[model samples]
Target: MSKSLTYTLLFLIMMIWGFNVIAIKILVESFAPVTITALRILLAGIVVMLILGIRKEFRKVTKPQLIYITIGALTGILGHHFFLSVGLTGTNASNAGLILGLVPLMTALAAILFLGDKLTILRMIGIVSGLIGVSFIVLNGERSVGSISRGDLYIFLAVVTQAVSFIAIKRATETMDARLMTGWMQIVGAFFLFVVSSRLEPDGLSTLTTGTPVDWIVFLASAILATGIGHMVYNKAIHQIGAGETAIFINLTPFFSLTGSYLFLGERIMVEQLFGFLFIVAGVLLGTGALEQSLRKHKQKRMAS
Candidate 1:
């Protein structure tokens, strides 16, 4: 319940999410994007259903809640995974890492516009900083203008869809249990992916047929640990605290993504990219009131002594 503890939870959730991106990229290489996304969510959904079923929670769902959950699954789980996987196919891992840094800013903007939350000057600055960070990453890559990679555009599409889903979840949370909502959403979304993947992917079933022990570990970690449990913790954290503070936790994603990419994929980070990463972190910290609060607390302690 303490602010410090809440922040720590948020940070851990972000690390899980960051690692997930790297895991997703690996899956994309070995499997069709849609196929992997579908299977992961479907498996996660089954796990969630089992958990809820044990608690007799599955029987309480009403008609309207079902509809809302369906929409949530489509927008957040389905659309988000589909676009992100599609994007990862065309873009470098580094670019995907950086582009995701904009989530907090986008979430804030969506909250303000759709959820009637106030957008303060600090958040405005954070939005600008995030945009600048996005620009730096895009330009630093020296990507072709006319022949922009399909992957990069897909990343942006993922962002837009995710923003919509976050706002929807925020509104839906007023009446629904976050866990139940998330579980159903994943189930419905997974079904959609399963159907689509079945048609587009030949030998798609084979992708999951064989893998090294490490591969299987990472895949389960991605689906169960990073996603199923990760989202549960995240929604809880955000529900306890406010979204602004929770959004700051997302700043950790790029750092984790970069580290995971390096250790797993052997990707090297350039100096410019590192600087951009720092700026993104700073922007998120400042935008979320974390930096300011820390400074204020430090100054107060100094003056008291």
Candidate 2:
């Protein structure tokens, strides 16, 4: 495929993931965070395995690769996404969206510390600016957890964990097919979440059975479309585009999530959210080289014409 087509497809994948943040928040209203996340992963993992298995590439995983896949699943699927869902239970959709913007910064930090990737001064500024914007959203927003927001710290932890997971994927990408790696990771992560839920929330399965049709639809969307397809696309994007570029698309997630929340969940956007969105957009535009790319593209088109 052409570069533009590849980037466009990846952009759409990222956009889908933004919608998922809202879907997951909706799912959490009816299910506990871990239970909801676990179920989604389990269902999505099954679908991914079936897809991979049909291609005859599913059984070729080596022992070391399996270990990496397990680790990746533990961090990315279990640690990151589960906590994110739980965090949504206490945070506003827009607040969560703002926090989600930090994924790229977190990824860049993880890359520098763990993956030995470049950490330019401009990148540091972008990361800090995004963090500052998130802080404004959190401090002024109504989310509170017993003197603190319930998911504030948890969601932050989730962001950090996801950053680490991104780096882990980057490392694994050197040796693994992004598809197989993601499929196995989700499968293994779902298993771990199942075990965790069994020990911690034994009532989870009962909750699933008790939910309404809307709940079921939300869960399925979260699992099948959001977690399965979205995450798979994310893994591929990271593999091909590298974490920094892939991470840039994440900044768009808050915009999609906020819009989804407003349309579906009856949530209203606040001034703080609007400002946060602007700062985040500006930061991301700088971080992703979008402004420069646009200008260059525009100049080329004009010159050509």
Q: Which candidate's lDDT is highest?
A: 1
Question: Each candidate's TM vs. the true structure?
Answer: 0.87, 0.87
Per residue, candidate 2 scores C-alpha lDDT tens digits across 1-305 of 56576689777876777777787887777776677788788899888778777877666777777777877888888898778877988886767877787776676667778867666666567666776676667766564434657676678888888878866676676787887777778878988888888887888877777678988877787778777777677766666765445656776788888888788788888887878777776666655444555677789999999
- lDDT (C-alpha) at residue 266 in model 1: 86
Please give, for residues 1-305, the per-residue lDDT of candidate 1 as tens digits.
78788777778878888878888898888777788789889878777777777877765677777777777777888788889988998877877887888766676677777777766677678767777676666656555556557787788778877888877776666787887788888888999888878888867888776666776777798889887878777877877886655766787899888887888788887665777787777677766555665677789999999
Where is model 1 more than 4 Å wrong at Cα?
1-8, 55-59, 286-305
Off by over 4 Å in 2: 141-147, 237-245, 285-305
CA shift of 71, model 2, Å: 2.0
Evaluate all candidate structures by whole-model CA lDDT and list the values in order.
Answer: 0.77, 0.75
Q: lDDT score of model 2?
A: 0.75
